[model samples]
Structure formats: structure tokens, C-alpha cells
Target chain A: MSNGQETSQETFAALEALKEHYSLPSLTFSVPRQVQGLVLPVVIAVVWEALAQTGILPANWLPAPSVVVATLLELLRGGELLGHIGVTLARVVSGFLIGALAATLLGGVTGSSPLVRRVLDPTLQALRSIPSMAWVPLFLLWLGIHESSKIALIAVGVFFPVYLNLLSGILTVDRKLLEVGQVFRLDRVQQVRRVILPAALPSYLVGLRSGLGLGWMFVVAAEIMGASRGLGFLMIDGQMTGRASVIIASIVLFALFGKLTDLVLERAAKGLLGQRGIEF
Target chain B: MGLAGAHRAALDIRGLCKDFAVHGGRVTALQDINLTVRQGDFISIIGSSGCGKSTLLRIIAGLETDYQGDAEFEGERINGPGLERGVVFQEHRLFPWLTVRENVAFGLGGGRENSRGESVREHIDLVGLTGFEQAYPHQLSGGMAQRAAIARALVNRPQVLLLDEPFGALDALTKIQMQEEVLRIWRAEGATMVLVTHDIDEAVFLGDRVVIMSNRPGTIKRIIPVDLPRPRDRGSYEFTHLRSAIYAEFFRQEDKPFAYAI
Candidate 1:
């Protein structure tokens, strides 16, 4: 055992020495990272310029990337894009918050108790099956063609996924862990806080990510239905005015926002659970 | 070590019978089982698979209350799980979301809020997991997680610690090490322990008396006293002899068809 330990120590030392000998320049940089971020957009702009110059497609149908950028810059300066974007973002955030909170609380209750699970399960399942768009007309009827209708649609869209995921996560908590809690005589609240809540978090986070994405989708769909403001309304307005550039710009912005939101969610999840190193 | 003047046994099993209704028919898991465990008794139950050793332990733990017989602790009938009887299952079953400290603290009772943090810390230290208190179950190795489970069970200071193949999932080296650790902890805590395992050698090593059971619809075949001193030598002639003797009894029960049939 002593000899084996010495050999392993020598092997580790050799590996470290090799790593130091062949070390490459560190890619770590403050400014270079920002430049790297611009690479994709710059490449796309160059490609668009080349295609427009070649006239491979009709100019009106496929406007140069510069033209789209100019249109976006003009819209921003006039406060049109900003106002719509702000409205759309506010709706999404409020709707998603309401849905996520309600789902989490209800999911926790149903997951811990069999009777509650039995009572609520079938109804939730029925509600979940109804498409988010299908609820737009009904919500409009109930709350009128207003912000409440859009928010309601988005909230319903977000609720089902979060609720199902959280409930399953709670239900699947290892019985052994519960036994451990029982042995200690942990009260119901402590058990929920210490065992049930934490155990259900990973699954809950997954649900949150998907729920937010769906919320974004439902918000756009709701805005398109009747709203006179927001990004989705802007797209519909652009369509009516035949401003292809504005339509394309709004779509691009929505995609970018979605990507950014996903990235932020991923980072948040990693920060919360990275140390524990839960694989799933 | 003395059984005298301890009132009645810490746990007493009388005419214990457990049956499970399977798809085929009613399968008897335990039949006419009787045992008495004095305070601080370390009893190991060993048998082949389906011999219902674990069923007996579960019954005593009050986890399985549907059994036909009675389990009494200090003259009171055993009911559902309580702080007095703690069970450690085969899997560690530590809550994945909870840190080691939190998991241990959970066993200290949720209603007793004021001093929980202190008690949880004490149990974590008792299990030698003081530094890893903030580490979640997913962060710990299998052996360490099992230790956390043990710590959780011990947090309630149960009168009896029932272990059902607690070390069965561990590697061989870890299993032996855990056996010793359990022996040391048992001595220190002076809690009555009932360990159920399929390994004869393990039963002989940890048990004051190894209880061998017959096959399905299980009943005790025999009780063999282990006279080895503390820190028992596994390689000693007496130890090996007793191990082989218990192994032989297990095989002998296997050879007899329906030895414990209803």
C-alpha cells in the first residue's frame, strides 16, 4: 500500500509537470469575450450584405440586414419598439409570476397528501389538456379584450407544466428519506421544508424553465388576438402596413429575448444546484 | 451487558405472523415468530432471500403494523413509527435537496423548533460528518450517505435501532468498516439494535446471538450465541467455525421443503 501510494503520487506529479510544460495561452479576457459575442451577428450582417449586392433574391422581399437594422434604430428612436417591448415584457413577467407561485403552492399540497392528489388530479389534467390559444376567446369573454385576458392566457399556459413537474418531483421523493424524517420525529412543516421542498426543487426548476418559455409564447399569441400594443401587436401592425423590415426586426428581437431568458435561467439553476451536482 | 433488572425486554415479539396477498395466492412472510430483545441487545437476523427476516424487523420497527401478532416495548403494544424506534433501510434515502446537517436535524422533530439546530449539529458531529454538514446527499459518496442515514436515525435517540440490510449496498471493504463503526456507535449509544441481513458472516460478527430463519412463511430455525469478545477477529478459528455452522443451518432450512409452511 505504501509503495502504491508513492507511485500514484509520482504519477500525479508527472501529469502536473506535463500540463505546465505544454500550457497554451489562456483565452480568459475581459474585452475579448465581448468581441466574441459579436461574431455571430457580424457574420450574419456580412452574409446579408453579400446576398443583397448579388441581388440573388428580390430586394423588396429580402431587405439587406443593414436596412432591417436601420428600421429597428428608427423604431427605437421613436419609442414605438421600446413601448411595445416593455408592455410585452411586463405582461409575461406578471402572468408567469402568478402562475408559477400558484402552481408551486398547489403542487406542494397535492404532492404531500393522497387525498388532495386524488381530488385535484383529474381536474388539473382536464384543464392542462386545453390549449393555451383555446383559452384566449374564453378569457376575452370572461375578462374582456384587455390586459387581464392576455395575462390570464399566459398564466394558464405557465401553470400546467410547473404543476405537473413539481407534483411528480414531490411524489418521487425517496420513501427512505421520509422514514429518516419519521425516525427523527420531524414535524410536518419541517419535513416539508427540509425534505419535500428541496427534493422537489430540481424538477421544479425544469418546469419553471419550460413554463417561462410557454408563457412567452402564450403572451405573443394573446397580444396578436386583440391587443393594440406589445411586440406581437407590433408584428400584426407591421403586417397590415406591409413593412417587412419591421416585422422581421420584431421577430428577431423576440427570438433574442427568448434566448437571453433561457441563458439567464440556466445560469440561475446552475448557481443554486451546482455545488450539490445533481445530474438530472 | 446485563439483561437482569431491565424490566421486561426492550422489545418482545409474540406469535408474530405476516402474510402478503400476491397475485397467485396469499404468501405468508412470517409465521409464529417469537423473540425477546433486552435493552442494548445487538441481535442479527440472517437467512436466505424470501425468508422474511426483514419483515420481522419492519414489524418491530412498527413500519409494518398489519402483522397478526404483537410487538411490545416495555409492556406497551407497538403502533406506528415513533421516535422510540428508528429504522435504517437498505438504501441511504437521504433527501437529495437537504444538506447532511438538515437531514439529521429533520429527525429531531419538526415541532420542537427552538433547539433543533443544536441537536442536528450534535448528531452530525456524532456521525463524524461535521465538516460535510452543508453537503447535500448527491455530494456524498455511498458510504458517507449511509452514515448520514444512520445519523438521522440516531438523532431521535430511539430506544431501538432497526437496520434492514443497511450496509448491503456498500462495497465489501466499506461494509466491514461500517460494521465496526456501527458496533462502536452501538456501544456508545447503548441502544437495542436489530440488524437483518442475508450474510451469515455479518450476522455472526455483529450479533450477540445470530438468529437463523427457515424459508418463506419464515420462523426462527435456531439462535446461536456469539461468544467473541469486542472487536471480534474475523479470521479467528472460533469465528469461522460459527460462521460455517450458521451457513449450514441456512442451507439445511433451504433443503427442507416448506419448513415454515402455514
Candidate 2:
């Protein structure tokens, strides 16, 4: 029994060694994951600031990280940055909601019915091919160069990905599951609500995230073309006045806000699906 | 036939024909199929691959509509799928988003009142999945998921339960265990079951009559009654004899050209 115990102990130790060898490397210092993610960004900012301080890199054309931060702080102090951010946020939110709603309706119609798919899918595919910038002039002429045109441009950008993803998502719902719906004698509406929508949810969530990313992109384009206010306007104003720090600050804010919004969407998707591996 | 014929028919199919369109031409899947399933009878359909055994089950389930001839349930024409006939597919087909309880409850549909007042809990317990009510489908083993699917089919108290190769995916041990579980549920529920399988032993073990079929332009070749008492011993001579009888039918046609052989 003692000899058996010794052999078992040796086997256990070997198993432990094998596990350690195969396991992903854990951090030695036990730093939180969120803080760990910040390390690279902090390192880059410090290096850029040091280079500027040493006069190795010129600050006028490409502002130092600290100068951009200082400029952002100045804008915050004047309360102008908040207004610009609010305007941009409102535009993106409205455009995203509109685009998502329209896509859901049309995607449902075309995805479920082959007849509608044959009638509309080709035309939608053609419309999707035209570049985002091409829509800017048409949107301006149709909706005017105000918030409407900007939102419209973002809506058009947001529409395609969501629509396409939802369409394919609905189209590809497992025929087996639909057969279950049929066997259970679920009506047409019940089939849509109970089977198709839930099965297609993961893909739909993917579309929403991509649509949101595109919404951010188109909002930038919309603002840059001609905006009285917004981060895009701030960038243009800074460039015209030769304030490179302010321009860099606006760019930084856009990056920050875009990432934050996407994070919100991802969190919502996670909460809705609960631990399923979302492809996006 | 005398024993099964004594009971009133739960499902009656006559002159059933099914065709599928291939690249250039139509291929016959099922041809001149005729069968009668009596009340509370367990019918197992055995065939080789491409025998259209599943196609027959689908036609009875009302999932296939373009078939020729009549399939009636309890003297009513099966124009489409109805609540009275529940089907369990090879895969569990549980909605991934719903829990086991939710998936079973879905058989009740959104707002349709359960007139019998039978609870989903009863069906879950019937399939021996009582403790797993809150579990997701992916968390369960193949046999366990299949059990949940059986529970979902039974929850509505369907008069005719159709199983299409339900245990075809399971390992040997799990398959045997699931077969026993199905037998128990069938006895308890008293629903007429038509199970499609390629396993001859499975057909002998559970079926009241095994309906053997010929391949490609599939047709019913014979229906042999299993008069053996339960619970059946798979090792018994009578059991092996029944199983081998079904096996001999498949190989008997080996020398003939398969499509034209029918």
C-alpha cells in the first residue's frame, strides 16, 4: 500500500507538471486584466512625451501626447468639448437606431420569403456596392447639409451591414429547428418570433456591432464635410488655425468615444446571449 | 397484422409517393408506401441509407407536403403539421437560447392553454430530466439532450409521436440506455410511436412491428410483428432471430440492380 501511494504521488506530480507546461502563462504580479491592458498605451504615451521634450520630434505638425491632453483639458474647461461630444453622440445614436430598425423590418421581410429576396436582394446588393463617400453629396442634396444629412449618411452606412447580416442570419436558421416549429404547429408569426429570430440573434448582434462601427466612421465623414459643431468640426477648426494639439485631441476623443460605444454594444450582446461565443 | 389490426388505427398512409428534384431530373425518394399504425403501437421502420425511411416519417409529420396520396391521422387528412402529432428528430433540436424547461414549455406554444392541465414538469420527470430543468442543451450529453427532446415532444401529450433516427448519433451504451428510456416513456405515455432507424436490433427491441423497406425509390418490403414479451433480452435467441430476419431482407437484394430491383 505504501509503495502504491508513492507511485500515485509521483503520478500526481507528473500530472501537475504537465498541466503547468500546457496552461496559458499567468501574470506573476497578479495585476488586474483591465490595468494590464493599459500598459502598452501608457508606454507609448510616455515615449512620445519624452521624445518631444528632448526636441527629437517636432510638436507643431504632430503634437506631443501631453500637448494633446492639455488641449483637451482646455476645451473641457471651456465646456465646448462636451457640447461637441454630445452632438456627435446624438447623431450616432439616432442614426444607429433608425438604421437598425429599418434593417430589422426589411431583413425580416426579405430573409423569410424567397419571393421578396428575389425581388429586392439584388437591388440592395447593388446599392451596398456604392462607396460611403458617394452617398455624402446625394444625402446633402436630398436632406440638406444640416444634422439631417449627417445622420442620413451615418444611417446609410449603418444600414447595409445590419441588413445583410440579419438577412443571412434569418436565411441560415437551421432547417431542423424550423421543422420543429412546423411539427409543433406554430403559426407564421410564432415561427418568426420563437424560432427564426432567436436562432439568428448571434449573427444579428454581429451585424449591430459592425453597423455601429460604420456609424462612427460615417459620422466622422459627415462632420468633416461640413459641421458647425462636433469633434470633426473641432479637427477642421484646429487644422485651419494651425493648432495641431487641438486637432490631435479631437482625433483622440473620437477614438475614445468610438471604443466606448462599441464596448457598450458588446456588453449588451453578452448580457442578452449569456456566455455564447459572439463571432464579432 | 391481426394483433395490430385489432386496435383502431392512429395513423393511416396509402399509396404515398415522394420525389425530390436533383440537378437535371427528379429522383424518387419514396414510392407506393402504405402502412397503418394502430393506437399505442410502437412501429420501427428499418432501411439502408438512401431508403427514404426518414422521408416517410417527414410525410407523416406533415413536414413534407408535395407527396402524392393520403396520410391520415385519426381519420383526418394530414394537410399540415398539427399539435396532435409531435416529432423528435435525430438531433435534439432544442432552441439554444432556452433552458430545458423553457424548451419543453415551448410545446405548449405561446398562449395556448394546456386543456389537459398537464405540467411541463411532469414530462421532464417522465424523461428522467427533472433535475436538469434549468440546464441549457449544450451542457447535456448526447443521451441527455435526446431525453430532453423526447420530453419536449411528449409535453403536449401528442397522440402520435414520430421519432426519426433519434438515437442514431449516440454511442452504443448511451443508445441502449436511451432505447430503454424510450420504451419506458412509450408505455407510460401510451402514444403511438413510429421510429425510423437503420439499426435492426433497435427495431426488434422496441417495435410492435418492424416495417422493412427497399432502397432508392423506397417501398415497404415487409412488416414483421415482434410478439416477444418486455422487457426484451437482447441476448435471447428470439431477439437475435428477429434481428437477423430483418438483416437477411437487406442482403437478399444484393445481386439485383438496386434502383430497378424495387
Candidate 3:
């Protein structure tokens, strides 16, 4: 081969070798970035374990890590932990579904038509400003102390974020794209279905993720009234008998499940909308 | 090619006047704009910045409907944007979410009416973007993106094609290349085309008749017809004559920064 051609071939081989070397270290570690996040939590756990063992704080008020783990394992063995998890999961899932569906439908309507917005937006905005927890007593009176009351509380919590985001998202779609729709002689219905919906999708996903987090937060407050089997009930029961370890165990489970469910939502959102440059 | 085809008006506008409400006062954008585009004609409207050339194209495309006087398409009163006239705007205006093939095929599936003529693939090939069908608008180069935009407008097989500064943002080399691509597509499709631009050479190179407009409250100042043969030589005497003839309309009033005397 000519000298220029030979050097080009050598350069190509060199680039291949460089890429392989660059990829090897990360491949061996397999998600080093994710593991790097664990360092802080592990440090906190070790500090807590050491402090409790040395009795720096009173043993009765703050239980040791060992006591919390032993109690959690005990609950798991009898299947009572599974039952508590199931009941809480059922409440959160149903409330989130009902809230998301109603908000999306109503928001779409009010976003497109000024008449609907004039009729409903003022009242909805008035409702949105009131703290969600204030409704707990009213819902207790209206829906009672059954699953219905708990689910209603969670549903109210989930609605506003989704509704507000969907309204703004649909309204903010690029006017230029809508002109393209107009040039093609698209009707209003086709414009919404094709152009408006896809353009607003990334914002809707943001609303969905935030609403998912708020749903978990309200489940605890919802179950505080007349609940006897959920994770919230376990927490209240431990507080009543002064078994701080049981209360702490339930709080730990809440934190873990909250993170786990949010992680699943983030992954699925990325899978659906990663190409459009939307991040959770 | 001459006054022979002028009698058969494809697009005819008479005593046209348009105004915009700007800063609580009326700003006249076009005044007494009269022009006739024949069937199978290639007409170019050339003017300076803020001269409302784009507004004229918009009116013809049915995107602007509040103008004074009559702007008719084939003797029908223009109402609003429709499928019969296809427009390629200054920017590519391709949806970032759509692939190249999908962007071109956007209007073909269903619009005002489903037109049956050339397929999407044929238009894509006409614009010289066959292999990059699956590429998104962001991934394509500027010229490639403009080509995709052209293909999208042509896929409709519209009775009239309207372009508003379609290649103004491209580099010099790419703009010339795209000018040739447009001429090729025009010959292949044989549709009436109206291009509005500020570049004098682009008007003379692409148009059978170059219509020069005066500045703000733009009006048809002059019309120069090209009598040269197919693929006219850019360096030849006749080509330079016609090019200078169009330039003379603007430079007729020298010692002024603007192209026309207000």
C-alpha cells in the first residue's frame, strides 16, 4: 500500500485499540456510577450502628440497627409484612390511576377551549391552593374510615400536579408546528391528536413522575385514619405501644419502597422518551 | 414562456393591500400588488429586507386571508390554507421528533384530500436524499434538511408550490446546489412555482420571469423576462445581461442603503 494509505489503516487500528482499552475498566465494574451512589448511605448506616452499640443515645428511644433488622425479619417470617405491603400498594395504585385519568381528560379540555377554561379554571385554581392534607378530615366524614376514604385522600393528592402540567404542556406546543398542521389543512381534532399530543408528551411525563411521588406521600396520611393493616397502621401501632423499633422499621420500608417505585418509573420514562431529550 | 401563457392566469392578484397591527398603529406591508402567474410558470419575487416579499408568498399560499382586493387561485376566491397550494418556509420547519421519511410523508397520509400521484420515495429521490430516509431533522446537514423540507412540500403534488426564502440560510455552495435541485424538481413535476428571495442572481437563475418589488409597502416595480436557453450559462454575455438587468432595478437609486427609494 502507499505510505498515506498504510498510515490511515494503522490509525484505524489504533482507534479500535483505544476504544477497547477505554471500555474494559467500566465493563469489569458493571455500573460503577450506580455503585458510587451507595457510598454515602453505607457510611450513614455504619455510623448509626456504631452509635447505637456504644449507647451514646438512650437504647429505649433509638433502637440499635440489629434490633430493627431482627424485628423486620420476624415480621417477614409470619407473612404479616407481606399483608401490610399489599394493602398499602393497593391503595396507592388505585388512587393514582383514578387521579391521573381524570386530570388528563379535564386538563386537555380546558387547555384547548377558552370557554371551558373560563368556566372551570377559576374554581380549579381556587381548589389547587388549599393544602392537600386539609382534606383528610372532610374525606373521612364523606368517604368514611374504609378503603374508600384512604383511596380518596391519595387521589386528591395526585390530581393537581398532572392537571396543571398537562394544561401548560398542551398550550406551550410550538406555534410553528401548528402552522405546518394548518398548511396541510388538518382539522382541529387531527391537530390535537397528532401534533399537539406528541409535542406535549415530555411535559406530561414530568407530571406523571411527580404525581407518582406525591401519591406515595399521601398514602401514609390517608391510612392514619381507622386503618388497621397497612404499613401506616404498623407505624401508628408501634408509636402507641412505645416499640420505637417497629415504627422505625416501617419508616425504613417506606423510604426503600418509595425509592424503588420511583426508580422503576424513571427507567420506564427514559425508555419511552429518551430520544426526545426528556429526563425524569 | 412568453405573454402567450400570461393570458391563462394560474394565480392573479389585483389591487392587493395588506396591513398589520403593530404597536397600536397600522403598518402597511404591501400596497397595490398586482401580478399574474401563468400555468407551468416559474416566477420569482425579489426585494430587500422588510419589503414584504414573504407576505406576498404567504397570501398566495392561503396562509394570509385579510388582505384588501382579490387574490384568486385558478379563478377561485382564496379563503384559507388548503392542500391545493404547498408551502416550503424559510426555515426547514421539519418536526424534530419525525424521521426524514416520516416528515416527507406527513401530509400524504391524510390532509384536506389524499392526492394520488408520485409516491414519497420518488420525491425523496428527486431531492437527492434516498439513503438518509430514517435520519432525524437534527442529524441531517443544513442542505440535507432543506432538501427534506422540499420533498415534504412536493409529496403533496400540489397545483402550486410556494417557497419563502427557502435557501436563504444555506452556505453559498449549498444554496447554488439547492437551486439546481429545485430546477430539476420543477422540470420533473411541472407544477407552477413561486419563489420569493432577496438575492438577485437566485431570482434570475431560477425564474422564467423575475418580478422586482419596491421597498416597504412593497409593489411590483418591474418585470424582466429571461429569453435564454435551457441551463443558461452563468458566465455568458446574455446571462450577465439578464442578471444585471434585474440588479439595475434595485441599484437604479444609488447613494441609499436600502435597495429601493421609499
lDDT of 2 by residue, A1-280 (tens): 2235568999999999999899888777676877998888899989998999888888887778878888989999999999999999999999999998999889989987889999999999999999979988888899998999999888899999999999999989999899888888888888999899999998898999999999999898899899999999999999899999988898889999999999999888988788333334
Candidate 1 stretches with Cα past 4 Å from truth are A1-49, A186-194, B1-3, B111-122, B256-262
Q: Top TM-score: which candidate number?
A: 2
TM-scores for chain A over all candidates: 0.82, 0.87, 0.86
Q: For model 1, how does the per-residue alpha-carbon lDDT over A154-246 read when each residue is reduced to its tens digit?
A: 988889889999999998877766666665656788778777787778899999999999989998899888889999998898889888788
lDDT of each: 0.83, 0.89, 0.86
- TM-score, cand. 3 vs. native: 0.85
Every model's TM-score: 0.86, 0.88, 0.85
Q: Distance (Å) between predicted and true CA of A79, model 1?
A: 2.4
lDDT of 2 by residue, B1-262 (tens): 3575449999999998999999989999999999999888999999998899999998888888888888888898888898888899998888888878888888887753441236788998888988887788767777888999998898888988999999998889999999999999998988999999999999999999999999878999999999999999999999999888888898785655556667
Distance from true location, Cα of B260 in model 3, Å: 16
Residue B126, model 1: lDDT of 72
Residue pairs in clash, model 3 = none
Candidate 1 lDDT over residue span B141-227, tens digit each: 778998998988887788889999999888799899899989988987888899999888799899999988988669998999998
Clashes of 3: 0
